[model samples]
Target: MELYQLRTFVAVARAGHLTRAAEGLHVSQPAVSAHIKALEDELGVALFTRSARGMGLTPQGQALLARAQSVLEQAEELTRAARSLRQQLDGELKIALNTDAEFLRVRELLSVLRAEHPALGVHLPQNMSHFIAEEVRAGSLDGGFVYGEAPPQGLEAVPLCSFRLVVIGPLAWRERLAGATWADLAREPWVWYSDALPCHASVQRWIAPYECRLSKVAVTDYEGTIRALVQSGAGLGIMREDEGARCEGAGEAFVWRGDSLPMNAYFLYRRDRESDPAMRAVLAALRAVWGLEQPLASAHMRA
Candidate 1:
């Protein structure tokens, strides 16, 4: 009956879970359920059937799905056409900044957006990749820079660049860490990152093959905190290329090459919202600055 309810129905059908649909819409699970229930009641038909695995569309629901999508697409096209006429961008976009925002040279993108869209309010918040991915999918934020092969389901991720994770420690440990095996590094106190971080997960997997018993002295998701800790001889940790190139080149920290993890970063945004004027503007700004390849239809999935 309502546009929001129709959108919720499509999201639920795509995700096959009430919780997942709620996340993509940035609403509570109960809210999603209510939307579906209201729609079904108004139309006098059952839309979805509950199962042990998840929600599934009934025969009538499947019959209605295509028409629903067409309606949504038509509405979106109307909005896009009208906005294209005025070209007045206005809205708040909250984006997630990963650990290496500086290294990624994101100032250029922000500068372009400021010069182009004076009415657009952009907020960049620092967070772990996993947390950022969830927020982007939940629509709390417009989009984000996330580290992983792909964005979460119901979102589209464009590959930004590739970087390798390398171990680094205080220069004082250079002599001690030379040729240090994974087992040796595991024994030492570590400047660990938030366990929820994608980098932390990757590092754990990379080291898992070594069968090392890892220990941590401090935990933080902020790169600055990790850098300071490692700089002050706290312990060793992983950093991507360009995390602290000057420090490593100056012998301030030991760059251990024994164990390394190859990784990629992506720009993640909700798929259905791509045609939004503000979102399109943001994507254009990123493309202008980063000059990445044409957006890929399928993103490789990774944690």
Candidate 2:
């Protein structure tokens, strides 16, 4: 029932292991168990079902978890609200991003938000797609920018932009095989991204027919690092067009623009706290800055 207990519950839900969650909270496993027990007793429902592997949320646990998270979020907001009683919009906004490249749109959005809502403080953290979505759902992050196939469960998605992937490589290497299909590219040494990323999954599918035989000499999880490595003569790699352009002049970076891959960037917000003024302003700023080509409805279909 206490705020700290709710936090413990949320962490346990996310980690799916009481011991791991306890470690993350820097507390003993007993303490974590006590907190969950207290919470479940107060609610008169079983919050989790435990097995040898870890913990899993029961149907009732899922429902209460959502409500508990919202309650904890609002409790923190109340503390901030008391301090900002003199102003309506003065508060910190924590936003998480899936990648560093997302800064392109974030910068444009923040510029307008700062101009109009000067009292609002903004904090941005760039992370992988899944992590960003997890933070948003846990209420640690107010909202976030994630680019991928779909939103994580329990979060709402708003399309910001739709872009495709391109293969970039050193000019000399590209010149050797200027117009290569997925099959042809499969024959060369390539830099592979980790499977956790959306782009990596796309690449796997694109080259699935060839069975990933294209010498994966180097493997990286970071887009920026992979781009840099590919430019440093590692091998051909996939990247967004704008990201490739930013490093084109410095490194051996050039977009092939031949492969048409679907990539959709979305703004994710917790469903329970979607009506917060800060979140609304951020959404408006995003749409205005991006000059959203079409309505969110249409964008969703293509995304």
Candidate 3:
């Protein structure tokens, strides 16, 4: 009957769990349950079947899911239209920062947004690349910087830049790795990234042809941890090209001459909210900071 109830319904249907839907909505579980109960009573039908596994959409709920989503989209479009007519942009955006702020030029982006759209506020929360994409798709985050081949479904991504991942080891191993092949390197202990990271896939692909398994001494999600471990002679690790160069130049780590993995960075947001004023302002500022040309294209598809 109410928009919030419909929103909760759609979120619950997508997540198929009360706790997750509540987290996505930023509300308590009880509140979410009450909303669903109220909606079901008003509609005179059960929307979901409660079971030990999780909430499952009933037959009627499955049929009405699309209509609920359409209603939400229409409401959002109306709000966006109203804001577009305003002389100045004014809203807060929750954006995810998947990597170091310095590397992403977040300060430069904030400066541009402050000057151009002073009324708009931005919040940047540090997150992992995979999690950022998921959060953006869930509508919990307005947008984020993600590293992947392309944006996931229902999202639009603007190509920021392309970079490579380089393998590095402690300075003590410089001579050892100088002429080492993939098999030789596999023998050495590695400070590897966890599988949850996108970089892990890159590393896996790079080593697939060689058919060797790395002996991981330490597995981490933080780039800083990997750098420190490699510097301490703990193990060889993979890092972004620029960071590896810096470490090698400073004599803190030795870069391996083997092939590097290619990666692309993108700024992603929900495709449906492309015309929102706050989203538009943020996108414009990001483009300026990254030196990308004006006028963002349609959602990037996976190739």
For lDDT, the strongest prediction is 3
Model 3, 180-233: lDDT tens digits are 999999999999898988777877988999999889999998899999999999
Query: What is candidate 3's CA lDDT for residue 277?
Result: 78
lDDT of 1 by residue, 42-67 (tens): 99999999998999999999999999
Residue 267 in candidate 3, Cα distance off native in Å: 0.5
Off by over 4 Å in 2: 1-87, 101-103, 245-251, 293-303
Residue 120's lDDT within candidate 2 is 88
Best-to-worst lDDT order: 3, 1, 2
lDDT (Cα, tens digit) per residue for candidate 2, span 33-61: 99999988998989999999899999998
Report the alpha-carbon TM-score of model 2 versus the true structure.
Answer: 0.63
Q: Is 2 or 3 the stronger prediction by TM-score?
A: 3
Task: For model 2, give the RMSD to the true fold.
Answer: 23.2
Pairwise lDDT winner, candidates 1 and 3? 3
Q: Where's the lowest-lDDT run of ten residues in candidate 2?
A: 294-303
lDDT of 2 at 295: 41
Score residue 272 of candidate 1 by CA lDDT.
71
